[model samples]
Each structure stands twice: as structure tokens, then as C-alpha cells.
Target: MSGSGSIITVLDMFGARLPGDLAFSLSQCGSISADHPLAGEIAAALGGKAASLPYPRRQDFMWVTLAPTAEQLRCVIEDLRCWVLPSFGWESSPPIVSDGGPAGRMGALLLAQSPQGYFRWHSRPADTDHVIARLATMRAVIAQAPARLSQLRPTLEMLRRQFTLGLATGDRDMALQAIDEIDQRQLDTASNALSMSIRVAAAFGDDQAIVDHPQLDNLLSMRVPQRVIESVLLAHHAVFLADLEAAGDIKAALAAYLPLHDRLSGLAGHPADDADTGIVRMAAYDAALAEDARRLHLLADRFAGDTVVAALVASPPPIAPLPILEPAGQPAPETEAQSVEPAFGEPLQPSVAELETVRVAPVAVTAEPALPLGWSDVPALVATSAREPLAALLQHAALMPDACDPGDGDFLIELLTDSEIIADTKKRAQADQVLTTVIDAYVCEERFPRRERLGLYETVLDIWSSSRALSTDPIDGQLLLTMADALLRLNGHLEAAVATMITRWWEARPVRSRLAWLGEALELLTEQSSAQDYLGLWYAGAGLINVDHEGFSVADRYLWYRLGRRLGLDGTATDEALGVDWLPLHSADDPLLAAGFRKIAIVSLHERAAREAAAQIEDRTQAHVVLVTDHAAGEGTASAATADVILFVWGAAKHAVYRAFDKVRDRLEYVQGTGSASIVRALERRVRAAGG
Candidate 1:
């Protein structure tokens, strides 16, 4: 049937041909029917009978009962090349239908009859090859399905099925395309799509694809379930191993794997909640993890002489249990709390000055007892230097405050910077947890007093300078920048601590990760202030890096110049900063300069940038400059039409304006950035390419 209405009618006519008892039996056995033109041939293959079904004012079709012997169904499916429903009584042994091109059409008919049956049938492996081979037919069928089928089960399930089939067949391109469609449709399966795409890329040994996939970070930034995040990270580790094997570099790979190994080990100790929730087991995921672990152990054995690998494969260190702490003024138990010795050195007793700094407010005694280390007990914890239990409390406790108090801020900073706390990795993580919690409460919530918040910002800066200087960890850098952004929003000042951190991160390497962080830092700096000295520091550090390097991409340059212009630098200054003036732009008699346009039109949304670009062009080539500030302005349109060259600032111009200038597109040069130097650079390239 061509349309869904006709397909439904055909299904109804076929049902009418079946006896009520037979129909009920077929329904009970979870069998779906499709009217086939060669139903007689299929019946002969199965040694069954076929009946002709009559339809009012439509072509008659042949139908057969779903009940058939297992051997007969196998013969009909494999030999006769006909679609056969799963055996009438058995639901587990799904028949493997050949990809004879009619299977998808038959699936469409079955879908019209029973959508649930359609899904159940496709969920098995029988439909995998058929789904891939007749993908276009299946798509059309789904698109033209009845509204009932569309409403009950949307296209998301179909997309997931295709993705699953692609993975099963090792069709990486197909799987990635399915994921892209899911993203384009704005489906709610964003996390699932991202995880699937990563696994697909890793399975196909496309390590670069996994690294360059745009949604990887987006998925990480989401509040995804623990299982999903773990799966993504495991896939990342697999990519790392693949790269390592390809390079044949054991030492470098070991160095990269240690941090990831530590992180994964920590996660492995605490399995995700999915294990206990009885969710469906991911067999592929488990198999991949096991394989990766085996490979890792092999690598470790090969490099057993190396100390790090030896220590890694060795038995893990035992983790000490955390002791419970009692609130202030509570009666102590017969046994005292056992305190472990600080890792740094002997524990220092609380000073009198530190005790005096904690302000204790009056509290009313209530009938119900308060929890340990509650609000009232904070002052005591701060005053007594109860570092160990206080660190535990901060880790597990909700740090939301009722008021902005300098006393709470001081105690948190003290706990975070405590040498004893920073010595252990777990405790250091807990300290970071406390820092983020305080930031969320004091900075993000904005319920705290401004003066107190500023004081906390300064304390954070001091902590970063003193303790985090040597850390090149991207996660730590992100957290630092987050705090810096918060501080900038409050006081409109970029702390020198942040500036130094950015410089250090950039100089560490010109890798993509570092460049991404620099881009974020540049955005923040540009937003807060247009100080040339501050902006020039980044330009010198990042913008001046060798283009031959792997990480300094064209997109990165565009961003740097765009932000530089936003910081009040003109074409000449920006060009000089990057030594671009050494080019032929300074020579008036240069052929490229002489061959430049007599009249050029620049279109942009940023008026000052547009004017500056125009000035730069006129100064370099002695050409007349026309500024197109508005798309609808007649004078702008007229100037754009007659100009010898039209420079459309692609990043800063509206799409409607670009379209309006389509009549002059032949002479139009698409400029990527709104900066004056970018425009001049583009013009020079165009002239040179035109045989100037």
C-alpha cells in the first residue's frame, strides 16, 4: 500500500480473512502479519496454505496464517527469500530475514498493523541488515506512518535502532550520521547520542574523530547520569590506548595514562548506581573495558622496570575510614575519636588569635537535638582547629549559609590551605569541593554581603597564587577561571593571579586544550576591560605563536583578533603586535598594494570596526572606501553595487544583508573577522591571488 490509510485497510482486510481464534492465537504469540504479493510461493515453501483477501474497490492481496513449523519458517525465510514473522509459539528465537529489499516495506506494513509488534520485531538482530540496507525505505515508511504510530512511538526509537545496528555492523559513518540526525532533531537523547558516537569512533579506531567530536565536552558539562559519564571516559581511555599503540611510545603513554588510571581506579571502587538499580547491562561496554584493562596490564608488564608502572600494577593502598565527629557541648563517648597523624607534620594547636576571630552568636536551647557540626557548632569547629573532622564535615555537609559572615569565610580558607589537608589527594579533592561549595553559596547565589564576597574573592586569589601555581591541570585551571570570572563580574578587575595563570597555561604548550582555556580567558578579559596592556599580553603569548604548530588553528586566530579589536586596538597596532607589518603592506610601490581596489565597500554590524577597516584599506592602497552600515539604506546598497570590491564581514554582518548583496557576490570578498587588520589581510590575499 502506498499510503498509511490504504495500508491500514489492507491490514484490516487481511485480518478479516483470518478466523477469530487464529487472530487471537497470533496476537498471543506476538506475531505480526504483512500482505505479500508472492504469498503463495511463501506458503508453498512452508508447506502451508494461502488465501486471497478481497478489498472493496482495491487490488486483492494474498495472506497466510503466521503459524508454521520452525523448519518450515527457516526454509521460507532463508531459501524462498520471503518475510516470515517469528514462530507462532516461540518469542525468543527471532527469524533472520534476508535483506531482499522488501523486508523494510513489510516492516512498514507490520508497523501499521501493530506498532508494538513492529518495535519488538526490530529490537532483535533479525532486522539489523535490513534496516541498514533499506534505510531510505524505512525512513520514508516512518515519515508517512499514521498519526497514531507517530504519537505513540516517535522517531527517536527508530534512530536509536539504526544507531545500534550501525554499531553492530561496525559502520562508523552510518552510526555517526544517525547521531548527527539525532542532534539536529534536538532529541532528548543528547547524552545517549554523544556516548554512542564516541563508542563508534573508538571502535572504528578513529582516534582523531573522538578527540574532535564537538559534543564530547557538551556531554561532560551536562548533569548526566554516572553510568553515561563513566562510559564516555572509558571510551576516551580506549582512544588513548589506540594512539599509544599507533605511536609505539611506552614512556609517553604511561605518563598520560597515570592520571586517567588514578581517576578511573577511584571510580571503580565506587560503582555507579546503575549496578544496583538493575539497569540493562552494556555488554559492548563491559567487553571494551575488559579488553582495555588487559592491554593496560600487558603494557605495564612490558614496562615493569619503570617505577610508575610497577607501583600501578601493585596492590592499591588501603584507604583509612573516616571517624565521626561530635557537636560542641555534646557529651563525649567513653572512647575518644581516634585521630590520624597529619600527613604534613605534627598538628598545630589552635592559636588564641584564631579562636578570637570566630564570632559566636547566642543560641536558644530547643527540645530537639541538633545534628553534629550544625550551624551553632561551626564556631567551635573553627576555634578548636578540629581540622580532620572539619574537613570531613565540609565534604559531606551542605555548606549553604544563612548569612554572609567573615568568620565562615576565614575558616573555609584556612581549611583549604591547610598543609595537612593538601597533602592527601582525597583530602585535597575534598578541599576543592569545599571551595566550589563556598563559591556557589557566596558568589553565585548573590545573597551574601558584597564586602564579604569581595573578601572571599581575594582569599581565593591568594590560595591560587600560593598553592595552585605549579598545577597545570586543566580542571584546576577551569575552576580558577570560573572564580576569576566571578571576581570580574563583581569588581570589574582581572586579578594578576589569573593573568599569571593564563600565561603559565599558554606557555605550557600551544595545544588545543590550552588554547581553549586562553580563548575563555580572553573573552573574560575583553568583557571586563579594554586595557591594551592586558590584552596585548595574550596577543603576544597566543596570537604570536607559530602557525605551523598543531593547535593554533585559523579559528583561534580569528577569535584573537576579534577580541583584540574589541579591546580598542586598531589595524596598525594589532598588525605591529604580531609583526604583520613586515609584510608588503608597508611598501607603497608593491604590486599587491598598487593592484588593490580603487573603491571598496565594507559591510559590518560593528560601526567603529567597519570605519577602521575602511581607513586601513584607504591608507594601505590609496583607494576610496565606502562604509555599508545598514542593509536597507539605499546609499549603502548603491555603494556596495558599484564598488570595485565588496568586503562582507561574515562574522559581524547580518545574514539578510549578505543575501541582499548577492547580486554583487562575484566581486564580494567574505571577511571572517570584524577587525581592521583582518580586513586588510583578506584584501591583500585576494589581490595577490588575482595575480597582482
Candidate 2:
């Protein structure tokens, strides 16, 4: 009688069999988690003697409750397939019913994230849509946890991220709907619900719901450390409708936190002494200017370039000016890339000054039809950034006219980089449009306006220079390089040109063939001008220090911290003298690496860098020296925390890369684009978050 289905099917199949959700409604049953009351019932149903275990299903089916471990599931499969089902004379494994396998797995993961659940079932995306649906439900449950349980919201919120909303279709509707249902259910004397009605409401697409919660504002107003702002943001969302009061609380809470993105925490020589706060108050004074640029963009105003320039003082770390200079890579072929194509739009005379007149101004009174209505106009967050001719860009590039020459390609490339086009931060699912434009240009080896590209690069540099710009915003910074790399690689010059454009900070090549090739490219760079190349290498390597020391295992992370040691290894007396002061090597259990490494790691490393401020024994182990990362965000981004370590016992987790890779290969292959499979796979490995 076992089966998986809608809420009705679950009640029909397991109402008498289990205790939790169904049992509460059915009177005779009261001991199982709602998502899977019959995990044990079904497992026991495999035989018929399953009535042995107690009811109210252990709170959760995955980790905290009734869920089977991956190994147990494997055992179940084998037992049923080989032994149990065979007794019934079945030749094949019985297909176990489930409500979206990945979604179930996601629930299990969410439960395990906190002390909420006692078990976890690790699995891969067998069915993506199911997983997506389940994830929506899980996030709703997690968002509601804090109010129901008191203060576990931040921790659960962190865990919530483990399951990708699988929405890039990043729609708010699914998440919002699930959140609403969870809120509707009351956990009274008969309802054993760990109710956080305030939390469930936090999942609303509107941030104000959280801020308007009856009790959320007061709870959020408490001054936690400056590091926990995101948590505060999450908690404050629980606060309900009187937004001005909530906004006042937010501003106050922010003030009490006292740490700015630029505040240097571990300052020595009488900090908190009150007399000298101003001395170092403006130490990185220029960062204020950078913040000026940030504030403007957030407000959608035109921040003057000099404001950005003043905020950004350091000359860009002498990056090699992409020596090729031309995106076309090859010599003048009188082809689409090299020669001017004056036929379409306007002539390409290299003057980007026309931007003042043509670029979309922040205060433009009239919205042109070319511009799709967006955040300002729409009542909802419709992702309009790349909706502009997105699908066309891909087709145009993918099916480049075999007969077209330089003019057409130039016109297309130049048009794509226009200020209005480039500045659009449309939601990612929609980004395919802009990227398609870039990709097509690459496919046809078309040269864009070099001046525009350089200007954008300079602006990016300015934005990032003063902690105000935020290099950690993944999609904007490194991912851009990845996309850029894909385009260059498509044109075949990706090899000779990439290393010059991207910092060595990002080493995305995991699929060996690609790494071997990138290695070959680096070789060319080294050969081009040995000394200058080495300097570039060292300069690039400098970007790696104390990165993300927390998230990785001791050994894997140690490899990165030893950057200085890797440099000058060839015994060059000259290379040795350059003497880079790499952040000291840290072990996983080291005082700094694991020492509550999870808390405030990013800001400590990048923003309010208090070098030794929060360093503690990372692992409680007796091991000396902890392993740290080159990018604190690296550990978080890489998902090092969730990566499984190989286990010998059924209870232990495994960090089986091969097994993991095998599980997701099909999904990767399915999502990969034409003629660009290798590059796409390489990037998915790098940017799809860490443990994933």
C-alpha cells in the first residue's frame, strides 16, 4: 500500500501507520514529522513487522528525526532489490515512493542544519523540480523556526542556503506561498508545532513584512556584534507593518553595531582609548570616497566619477594591460572584428563620450520604450535587466552569418556595451540576454569598443578598491571574468588573453583537460617577458592571502596559505628578495582558522580587518596550526562546510569527490551549452557555491 503523492495520498496511505502530521489529525497517530510521517512506516512496510518503533516520528525524517541516511537508503535498496523483494519473487528493485527526492533531501538537510533534526540523508538531484519544490517548503519552515523556537533563525538561515532555491527562476512566489501555509498552521496543545509565525512571514517577497512583525522589531533591536547584520536583517524582517518604527530600529541597530565596512578592527596603539580614534578613523580615508560611489548606485543616482576617483586612491595593482589590446586576437583580416562597420547604427570612432547623451540617466523623466519597466515602475520585482533582446543575442551569436565581415560584428559588440546595457543588474535568470550578447561577440570574434570595456573595468576597479565596492559580490566580479573567459575561449584566443585579464586569484579549472590548457596559457605569459611575467604572477598571487581560512579542511586550505613558499621556488635570488608577507599559515584547528572561524570571517579578512581580532582555536582538536584560506568568502562560497568527508561507518559523512561528480554529471551535461561544454563545466565547478 506504499506510495508517494499529494497531502491526501499521504494521509490515506499512512494515516493509521504513523504519528506526526497525519496522526494529529487522525487522533490515533501523533508521532511523526509532517514532511514524512511514514519514513519509518514505509521502511517498515518493506517488511510487515515495522510496528516496532515509537511514534510521533522523531521530529524530522532526515537528520533529527526519521529520515534514512544515504547508506541506509542504499542498504534498503539492496535489501529490497536483492533480498526482500526477491522473497516476493520480484526481479527489479522496488521503486520507493517519495515527494520529490531532492526536496526530501533538502528537508533532511535543513533539519540537520540545526540541532533540529538528528539524521541526514545525502543524495543528488534525481529529480530537480521536486527538489526545487521541496526547497521552497524547507526555506519557509526554516524562516519560521526562530519565532517558534527562539533565536535559531540566523543559524537556520545559514543552513537554508545549503539548498539552492534552485530558482534562478529566482521567483519569490514559490517561497512566499510555502511560508504562508506554515504560518497558517497553529501549534496549540494538540499541535506540537515549533511555531515561528513571525519567521514564516519573513519569507515574504516583501522585506517590510519582517520589519512589521509584532515582536520582531524589539528582538532585532538588540545590539549583537557588528558582524551579524545579515542576521539582524533577517530577524528585523519578522517585525511587521509599522515600517518607520522598524526602520528607526534598523538604523539604531546599525549604529550600535559600530563597525563600518571600512572599520579596521584590530588596530593597535590605544584603540578604544578614546583619544586616538580619529587618528586611524580616517586611515583608509579614501575608502569613504569609494563608499560614495556605492551609495549613489544604491540610490540610482549619478555618482560623479571623481567622487569614485577620490574614494579610490591606489593606482590599480599594475595589472598587465591585456597586451592583445584587441578582443579580436588575430591580425587584421578585414573581417568582422578588425575593420570598422559604419553601416549599422553609428560609426565606431572609439569615442565613448556619447554616453553622456545616450546612456540612460538616473533621473530621466521619460522611460523610452527600449527600456523595459523595472524596479521603479513595477509593483513587483520583475527581472528586466537582460530581458532586452536576450534570446536574440544567443541566436545571433550562435548562428553568426558566415558571410558577415568586421562592420556588423563591431556594431553589435559596441551596441551591447552601451552604458545603459552594461549597467543593468537584472536578475540572473534574465542575464542570459546580456551574456548572450557577450557570448555572440566572442563566438564571432567581434571586437567591442575597447574604450568602453576599459572604462567599465576601471569603474569596477574603483568600485572595489575602497571596501565600498565589494569584491565579494560573486556575480559581478569573478563570475564576470568567467563569462568573459568563456567568450574569449570560444574565439580561441581565450588561451593567450585570459590570464592577462583575470587575476590569478581565481583558479576555476578542475576538469583536468581545461587546467592543463590554462597551464599552457600561463606558460605563454611567462614566456612573453619572463621578469615582468613573474612580477605579474607575484602580484596576482598577492590576491590570495588569508582568503577564506574557515570553510575548508586543514590540508586543502593549507595549500593556498603557503603562497609565498610556492613563489621563488625556482631558487631565483631575485624572486626571493621581493619578499611578500603572506598572511601567516593557519591550520584547520589553528588558533585562527577554525577558531569560531565561521563567525565574522569575511569582514575580518576583507573589510574591518582586525587581523587577530577573532582568531581562536578553529577546531577543538589538539592539532597545531589551523589551515586558513586566501578568500574568507572562499570557504563560504566553496561550501567547504557542507562537503562530505569519506566515512568508514554508516553514520559518518563522505567527501567523495568522484562519487559527488558522478552524481551531478548528467545535470551538468544537460545544462551545458553547445561547443562550450568544457568551459561551462569548468565554471559550474567554480561558481556554483562550495560544497555543491
Candidate 3:
């Protein structure tokens, strides 16, 4: 064979016929001697005299110019083990060649071929060192090569093969190195890598390898093939139990084994899907199942006195085989040249340029008006007359409560506290008259229901608190306090609105009187209220404590203790709630205690806050927490849809940002606060409310 682009031209000048003997030699040896009868025929094909022509060596030239018959090409390929390409009269444009002989050329060809071909060739037994060296060379080539669509599948295959061979030969360093490389590459083959790693780790009986693998969490978080996950987890557990048993730690071994036994027993009773129909392609999977069964039998014999294990061992779940997926086909080329031959008499379709010239009428679109950022900007019903404007507004509100806009409450409060109205004696008198009229209508049993009155109370609290008024007038303070008391008593459920309003009211109160008022409000809470209500009240009180500004004071501690007792919690809960190092309340019967959600996706724009929240929830509940910091990112929608519960940090996220999770709205719960403690509290309340 020759190097790239080398060609040897041959021409049939004499066109002499070959005799039977020379034909047989040509067929057998794939060559002819200069003295043979057909040598002149071969020489003539090279456009040379027989005696003057030099004999060609098989390895000397990359491409021979002779036009060989089909039989001769077959002889060269089968007998000589050389690849032969018959030029279809296109010698002037031969295929691109790599630098090497037939075998090297063949290897390069395999590399350029589809992923399936590459994998098939590399999987064959070879010198381990040679394979590794070749892989290293290929890595460099791949790294330097322009990233083409055609190279993706083949590259993934190469990495996978490296990982496989490394593990097979007990070169853990090599295996781990391959894994590290895969991570560094940041390709879309993470699932494949995870699956391969899990299988190899299980096969090698290295439970720690699987358990401690960096990608283990990813394997758990991602939606890999169900059969693969189940099989790998089972194998991992079995290996761990075996190791424990061997070390004479029977108790630890039993603790690990019993749960798996119970799970299998439950699965046996349920028998989800057809166990007979499920088939896995991995021999290691089948081996793991058998090994686990044997281990379980051994455990049953060793711990014969244990009724639970005996019962579980008596009937085991059938190990279902899952069908193995075939290797994925190579992706289609990104672009392909197509030659379009026009039909003899067919009319041509309009070209893109021609179509672009044709104009289409624009369709009218009626877009919905955007909502205002704050309630103050929204338009509300205007008073019919400028005179007695406050009174007219109140009258209209009372008459049309159902038709009243959300901004009406804000507008009403604006009029009540307007500087011009409050400063002017006559205007203040008119505002007071309208305010009394509205309060009377609000408090009336027949006119405003309890829910409507609660809403009005929340509106007043929100507006007044946001105004940051420093009015020390006894009547003004008392009026707000009285409304807060009524709102708390009237609201049966734990509403976020109530919590927010209470917090705001506490924040707006005089510093000297705030704690006293909050303590009295806490005292007024009835035992009939849910723990959620108590927590909501505590959240409001805690908002005003400002432990970060001033160290946890005696009064703050006492307040937290009081709030804790109301929630049926102890001093530990109080301590946690009071300090920065907080822990979620745990009890044997607490709904959030051991709440086994597989995943909880927390979506927030605040990265640090989201991470803190995830850490707290994960620690408390022992559940996987997928922190989606950017709502618009790739994983947000998937996490939202897959998580058992989605805790959206309402305060940290924007309205438009969270619309991506609209499809999973039913699973979504708006967390009222962004702090870790608040997120954990929200999770607890949500779990309790769902009776989890």
C-alpha cells in the first residue's frame, strides 16, 4: 500500500488475451510474472513493454492502476487479506486516503464510519496497552478536530469503550480517568456513562465505587431507564450487605438487607408489569439477581429466628428481565447535497425568492393589556363628582362589591390617608365620613361576609404598613390593631395574605409597642387552629424580631418559646427558630418527619437562597432537592414536572419568570419566604396539608 494521494496508472495498450495457466496464477496469487503469457497483457494494461516494466509489490502502492476482474479482486481480499477498491472509471477523483497501509487505512475508515462500526471494531480483544495508546491518540485527534455532527456518536462510543476496557482489566485509574474525561467533555452522553459505570462497578463487586461515584447522585436525579436503575440499586445493596456480613457486622448487614427484602416482598405481592416480558441485556444484571437471591437464602438460614426475614425469604419477588435497547444509530449528516432533475413537462413550483415577493394580509391580533407592577397604578372606579369624592367612592364600592376592582381597595386607602385630605379640616372630615361608612358596610353581617371583611382588613393593613407612618395617635394605632384581631379571628385557614398583613402591621408598629402587641396576638390564637396556622403566625412574629440586627434577645427568645408551645413544639424547636442555625421540627408523628419524597424541585432566581433552601429541605426530609436557580434554564421544567412537590420561592421569582412551570401548576406550591427556614416550614406545612 502507498501513502495518501499516490496513484499508479495502467493502460491496456496491447489488449492481449490471457491463457488458461496464466489466468489461474493471476486468480490464485493476485499477480503475474513478466515471463508469463499474460504478463504482456498486464504490462499492456500499464502501457509498458513486458521486459521493461518493474513488478509491483503489494505494500509499495496505495492504489494500483490495473482494472482487475471481479474474481481477481475477490482473491486479493479473501486470500491476501487486503482491501481492494474497484474504481468505477473515476480514477481522477479517488476517495480521500489516510496515511497508512491497508490495516491502518481500515482503522481510519472504521473511525470515519458510523458509531456502530467503531464500537464493533474496538470491542474486540486486543493488547490492552495498545488499545490504551490508540485511545490516547484518538482523544487528541478528536480534541483537535473541528466538531462535526458526524463525530458525536463515534466520540461517545470511544469514551464508553475506554471506560469499559479500563474496568474490565482492573485498571480503576484508567476507568476513573475516563469518567473524569467524560465529565470534562460535557457531552449529552451522561446517562450512558452513568449506566456503564454502574454496571461495571457492580460486576467488579465494588459497592463503594457505585455508592461513591461522583455521578451517583446524577444517576438518581436523572430519569435513566427504570430497569437499569432498579437493577443497579439492587446490586449495589446486595454487594454492600455481603461486605457487611463478611466483616462480622451482622446487625448492620441485617439492617440493610431487611428493607430490601421487605420491598421485594411488597413488589412480589403487587407484581407490577409483566415480569416475564421484561428482559435486560446485561449478564451482570442477571448475575446480580442470582447472587442476591443466594445471599438472601444464606441470611435466612443464618437468622432463622427472625420472623420478618423468614417471612420475606419464604416468597421472593420475581426478578423481571427488561428488554435491552439496541445501540443507537448514527445521527444523520447535518447537510446533504441534493440534485433536483426537473420533469420533462412538469410546471415548476414557485421559488423561495418568488414566494417572498407575494404579500399576505397581516392578521389582526388583540393582545391582552399588561397588568400594573403595583396595585396603585391600576385604574379604579372614579367618583361621579369631585365634591364628597371619598363618600361617592365608598358608596359605589358598597353597592358593587362583586364589580369592584382590586385597585379599589388601594384607591380607598389612598383617599383615606391622603396628605391633602388629612391636612385640610374639611377634606379630613369628608374622608372620615366615607371611612366610617365603608367600615360599617364591611362589619355588617348581611352586607359584607366574614371573608369579604377579612379581605378589607388585609387591604387596610397592607396599605397602612407600606406607608411606614409614625403616627403615635392612640386612636389610629387602636383602629389598626382592632382590625388585625378581627381578621385573625375571622380567617379559619392559614392564609399567606393574613401572614403578610400581620408581618407588615408588626413592622409598621412603634418599636416599643410592637412586641407587646405581637405577644397578645399570639395569645389570642385558639388551640383549634392547625399547626400551619401557628407556624404562619410565628412567621409573622419572627419577621419583626430582627435577630440579625440585634443578637437574639431575652424577649425574642421568650416570643419564640411562646410561638413554639402554641405549635406543640419544645425548647429545641424554639432554639432552632431563634438562632441562625435552625433545624426543622421533627416528631414521630410529624407529617414531614421522614417524608420520603424522591425529589423536591425548588425554583428561585436567588441562587444562594435556593441552594440554602435545598440543603435544609434535603437534610430535614432526606429527599433529593433539585435546585433550579434560573427558571428559564433547561432543567427547570423537567425538575418541576418530575419532582413530587415544587416549592417555588414566590418572593424571589417574578410572575413572568415562573410561567414556564404552568404545565406543572398542580404540583407547585408557592413558598411565602425565601429563607431556608421559611422554605423548610413551607415544605412541612405542605406535607401536613396533603396528609403525607
Candidate 4:
């Protein structure tokens, strides 16, 4: 019999009858997937005549029949208790029991009338308590679903509204926040066009960030919001005018601003919609644009007759003087201990007679008219008559171009080293001025190839090293360092500078901290990781200056590892030197780390060798055939091979066949020397026997 738990006594008065259609309908059962087994079971329990049904089609008010046996009734109640009721709590939709009276639909309310009310249903049938308890539990989940949906709806709507307002008001911060929220919630389900436009505006607003961002054009071409597109177009002209005004170019500022003002005025004419706030914003923008234009025009009129403005319009700005940065990590001025010694390897004292005779300017030389020598002949002449050789070279140098070729560079080296010329302060000063001119020419030539430029620097340093007075004039030293910094910035070989600094300029050099020099060196490694090996050479130079220099510290090791990490090297011992240590070590004590560091250092030398070999291969334009040998160390039989050029390694394998050849030769030579004539003949017979 169908019965309510609250009215067990009144159920018999209504009129009891045989259980002809023992059935109950549950609305919450609709949420199950169509393929779920529970759907078929519910249909079977209703009656044998019931047809199979899928979820939600008939399960929304699914009615199931109770079997006649108590065991069968228990089985039907158990399925509802274990499977169907729990599913309703997890489903996104709310659940409710149906097809009973309106009073039965309020089943959870009737069950809650007494907390221990399950005993009220015990008189009805076997295991009825289990069914009552499950129904009550399912009712609780249905009640909570509506409350959860209410909370989520408002937050999502607020974020969407904030994003829309941000676009309308041109507020980058608010727009970014909305974008972040939308991403976190996965609410921007359709298009990210508005989000992308906001990011572009934020990037463009920052002067420093925009300088290197090459994607402004790409962003503009994307499917961004129309309002964002309009704003950016106006902002571009505003930025240009602001830049010109900052540079003191009043005419250019006026030219850039007036067009911007016209664009804004044109926009204000086409009001977006009556409800749209864009028209009001355009009016505000118009006012701002007009003010900027008026200010720029006024400034242009005020400077109308200024001579500086007239001169600026005619030509570009003059080159600014190179600013001298204080030696890295050195806060204090140079002390007596750090001051440079005298030039020409001599004492600070100069005699009155010496001072009088030393002319700082060049003196006129009478024409002697000796046999003219070639650039190659200067080195040979210097070996014979040193004084006459240098004087002759300087005279030849005077007739050469401002930018010296390798030949002129060779002659200049001879002049710089000539003792007689250096002894005469005027001639030494004159040669220095010539040296200055040569370096300036190197700097000014935009099209000079890297190899030729590198050779020029090496030649100059070699010449400077040859001089007995190794002390560089302060101005000349600064010029060399400046040239080095510039060459390095252009990704040119700066190892020559490192070599020059170590060999010629080390004694009186003002490089205070090796760490600071390393930081400068890292900037030059933009294109390749091969430059990292040069740091070891730098450390070697710094080591000579101190027993315990910065290179020996754990901080230096960490810096090296950090650089490797930036290159995306794995933390293998050979690559990362045992990873970065945050704490500085007193000394690099780990032997494994040290070995890996040494391995890391050899990259630069290997890269340089490979580059040179490639260059040699490229230079052979006329040769019909090219033969490269791994045996060529620029010496021995490999150099004499009748081929275009000899590379130290070749082929896809990059095989060093020379090393194997040397090993075999060593064994053959040992056998040849140790054997008697008869034994040698026997060995040669055996060698021929093996070959045949």
C-alpha cells in the first residue's frame, strides 16, 4: 500500500486496497547519462511490461514497481538508496521527487519533522527505513544547488562588466585585472580579441618596454576590439608629438600634433550611439589635443628667429663626447699607489736640457731622398739600422691615408718601437697622434669586415708590446679601451682587448673588480655561447694582478653557472659546474665543479679554430678542386698538399685524421730506428706482405 510516514494511522481510513500498481516516481533520477545501467534497472522494477527507457526521456518522473516478495522489495529499495540518490547531489541540476501528491513532493520537510522519524515508517514494510533515510539525504542536495548557482553568477557577471568598462574608459589596470579573472575562470570562451588589445596598450605606455617590443604592428593586425583600435591610432600620434617636444624640436612637434588634433576632431563628429559614452570621451580627448597643439605652435613661434633652431634644421646633431665611467667597483679616486708611472721605462725626473729639447709638436724634416723601402722592408730595416728605419717609416706614414691598411699598420709599429723616435718626445707625440687618427678611422668605417678589423687591433697591440716604454699615454690608453668597448658592442672580437690589457696595460690598469669586468664581458655574448670561454682568459689576466682575485671566489663560480643556466644548459657536471650556489664560497673547492668549469672554457678556442677553417675554405674561388686535410696545423706535409687550402678538420664527421697518422708514424719510426738492416728489410717485407 502507498503510505506517507507522517499519517500512518490515517492511511487505512482513506481505503486500503491490494497493491495493483506498486510504483513511485523520482524526478531527480533524470541527471544520469543515457547509457548508465541504473536506467534499465528502474524500468524493470516498475513492471515486466514496462519498456526500456533512456535517461531524462522517462527518468525525469521515473516510476518503478515494487515486487511481491519482501526480498525483491528490499532489492528495489537498496538500488535507490545506494545509486540514484547520491547522483543527484553531484549533478549540476537540482532534484525533486514527482507524480506523488504535492504533500509527497515536500518529502524532505515531512522527514525532518522529527530527526529520528525513520521509526515512523517501520510499520509499513520490510526495510522501509533504508528508503526513507536515502530520500531525506537527496532532498538536502537539491536545496543547496540553487544557493551555489546564485553565488557564482554575480562574480562572473562582475568580471565581464569590468572588462567592458575598462575598454570603454581606456583603463589599462582595470582591463588587465578583468583579463586575468576571465582567464582564471575560463570565461573568455569565444574570443580573446579585447584581452590582446589591452596588453598592447599597457606595453606601449611604458617607454623602456616599448623600445624592444617588435610586435606592435603584429598586435594591431590581430582581431582586436574596434574601440581599442581607435584609441591606439590616436595614441600613436600623441606619442610622436611628445617625443619631438622632448627633443626641443618645436617645428617637428607642431607638425606631429596638428594632424593628431585633426584626427581627434574628426572622431568627435561621428558619435558612436546615443547610449554610447564614446562621444563624451572624444570631446575630452579633443580638448586635450587642442591644448597640446596650441602649446607646440606657441613654442614654434617663440623660437622662430633663434639661431640654434636654424642650425639644427640644417644639419644633424654633432657627436657627443665619450663619457668616462669610473673604473668598475672603485668608489675612491686613484691614490699614490694606483697612479701611473713615467713613460719610456724611465724615472719621473726629467733634466732641464731634456725638457727644453723635447718638442711636443712635429718638426720639419729636410728631404734626404734615400732608396724607398716597401711596407715589408720596414721590419727588415728595423733589424739593421733602427734609428734610420723608424724615421723612414714615420716619413712614409705621413704620406699614407688616415685609415691605414695592414701595410701602413706594419710601418706604424716600427715607428712606435724605434728608440730614437721615442727618445725625441715631439716625434713620439706625433706618432701617438697618428696612432689616434688610425684608431678613429677604424671606428668610423661602418663597412669594415670583422676579420680585417680584428687583424688591425692585433697588429697595433703587437707593435705597442714591442716598445721598451710599454706605458701607454693616458689619452691613448683611454682611446684603446673605448675602441675595445665599441668593437665588443658590435660583436667583434674583444679577446684582442683582453690580450692587450693583460700584456701591455696590466701594470697601471685601473680595472678594480674582476666581477665588474665580467659583467661587461657578458653583454658581448648576445649571439653565441662560445664567448663564455673568454671569461677564463679574463680571469687569468685578473689573477696576475692578485693572489686571490674575484675569479677564485664561489660567487664567481655561481656567476659562471648562472650564465650557463641562461643559455639553457642542463645541470650536468660538464655543463653547469654543479649548479648555482646562492652562498659564496671562500674558494672553489669542489674538484668535479672545477673540471667542468675548465671544460666550459675550451668552447671559445674551438669555435675560433672552426671559424678560421671555414674562412679558409671560402677564400678559394679560382681553384678547380679543393682538398682539406685534418693533418694541417699550418705546418708539415699537410700544408704542402697540392690543394686549394688546408683545413685542420673536414668532412661530415669532422675527423682529425692527423692524430691517428701521428700515432702510426710514432710506432713506425720506433721500429725503423731499433731494427738492424736485415730486420728492417724483413719488416718492410712483412709490411708489403700485409698491404698486398
Using all chains and alpha carbons, the TM-scores for the candidates as numbered come to: 0.29, 0.22, 0.26, 0.22
Error of 3 at 675 (Å): 3.3
lDDT of each structure?
Answer: 0.46, 0.28, 0.43, 0.35
lDDT for each residue of candidate 1 in 432-470, tens digit (9 for 90 to 100) = 555544543344321222544676766765565455655
Whose lDDT is higher: candidate 1's or candidate 2's? 1
Model 2 segments beyond 4 Å from truth?
Answer: 1-412, 418-432, 436-472, 480-496, 503-534, 540-692
Q: Ten-residue segment with the worst summed lDDT in candidate 3?
A: 114-123
Candidate 1: which pairs clash?
A: none
Q: Write the per-residue lDDT of candidate 4 for residues 374-405, one digit (tens) a residue.
A: 44554444444455655555444432222124
Pick by TM-score: which candidate is best? 1
Work out how many backbone clashes candidate 1 has. Answer: 0
Which candidate do you rate higher for TM-score, 2 or 3? 3
- The TM-score of predicted model 4 comes to 0.22
lDDT of 1: 0.46
Give me candidate 2's TM-score against the actual structure.
0.22
Candidate 1 has a TM-score of 0.29
Candidate 2 positional error at 293, Å: 67
